[model samples]
Target: MGCASYVKRDEYDATIAELRANDARHDQRLDQIQATLEKRFADYDARFAQFEGRLHVETTAHFAYGKAEVREADKPMLADFAKTLAAHHEGVLVTVEGFTDPAGSASYNKRLGQRRADAVRDFLVSQGLDADQVRTVSYGEADNRQIRPGAWGDDGLANRRVALVIDFVEAVAAR
Candidate 1:
């Protein structure tokens, strides 16, 4: 007769219980990570507004007045945004629209705005987004688009911003 080995019933139960505990720990950790990411995204003041036409998603992030460089604090949020764009959204055009706080001449502000937009677009591209899929536009102290017109310096921070628009060409319904 060949010798046979068997696991006791208690031993089997303990093994299964251990596996369940490990799985639960993993689940809880995942939940914690998710909450952290959500909070970080919100803290950066990211807003999304969907348009009825071709504009699918609009997320705006404020920038420092008269500065074209992307802030270091904004990187994590931007990376997350870029990841979402790369993972879920495809065949969509990403437009980064730059605005100014009316701190200078209209022409100068326009160029500053374009630099801001280009900086953001470059960052997005660095985060794995396609360069061709992204474009930049400068509104540059447009009165209509300003959050607080004639408000520059500390008060005009809100007006200085870059808005990213995801244009869904294929998703548009037939006219």
Candidate 2:
């Protein structure tokens, strides 16, 4: 009986030892899983930060005129538009484009169109925007407004205005 009792005690001790080893292995695996999850979360956080930094917005505003002359009332609108462009100066650019009607010679119209763009560019510069921040271009007698019904009397006036082009960094990169 004594021998049998001693053998049973020895078996019980071995079973407990094996169970403790198994538990230790399971604990180690749990710790590894936790570490992996933490690493993934950190990686995701960094990616999201990069995405937020790259995010941007773009908008276009139009200013029109008659007889190729800018209206005094349009001053405020132009200023506001300039401000909008300034807001996007970080990784963004503004294009001041001028257009003219088909009434005059293409060469003359091109020069006039350039003047219109230059005027807008100068105004924007005066309002605290950098001259380099805006680019001026002219499209003479091109990009006219289409109208089929009525006789286009002074299509030149509407064509003789400046158009704003706001481009963001991401958009430029995509192109």
Candidate 3:
């Protein structure tokens, strides 16, 4: 009877030991799964952040609209506008794109557009903006305003203006 009792006690002890080992293995696997889930969520968050940054640039803020008809009278406003541009688009490159309405001859409009772009570039330089940071292009009437045949008027005034565009080759971290 004493030997039988000893054998029963040993069996009980071994059963408890086996249960403890199983519980430890289960806890370890649970920890590993939790760690993997955290890593995956972090990766997904990073990808969405990059995608949102590109969307912000594309959706908001038009870097266009210089001034009306590059006239001597527009000179003062040109300086003011340069400061505005510098303040708004400080680190980004600025391009002076000029366009014209469809009324003028194609060749004349082309030359006019070039002149308009040049005028804007000069104004920006005079206002302490770096000349190297600014570029100029002329589209003339190639990308003219679209309006109904007779309904077109000075409504196209906005179209006959220079535009500044900022670009990014890759997703940049915000400062």
Identify the candidate with maximal TM-score: 1
Clash pairs, model 1 backbone: none
Cα RMSDs of all predictions? 15.8, 23.3, 22.2
**Which structure is stronger by TM-score: 1 or 2?**
1
Residue 135 C-alpha lDDT in model 3: 75
Candidate 1 lDDT trough over 10 residues, lowest sum: 50-59
- TM-score, ranked from best to worst: 1, 2, 3
Compose the digit string of candidate 2's lDDT tens values, residues 124-150: 888767776677888766744311222
Q: Count the backbone clashes (under 3 Å) in each candidate.
A: 0, 0, 0
TM-score of 2: 0.52
TM-score of each: 0.69, 0.52, 0.45
lDDT of 1: 0.74
- Candidate 3, residues 54-168: lDDT per residue as tens digits? 2111111111233334565455544654564455444434567666665667787677777777877887788967787667777776743322222213555544655544322
Model 1 bad stretches (over 4 Å): 1-43, 54-60, 169-175
Worst 10 residues of 2 by lDDT: 44-53
lDDT of 2 at 102: 62
Question: How does each model score on lDDT?
Answer: 0.74, 0.54, 0.50
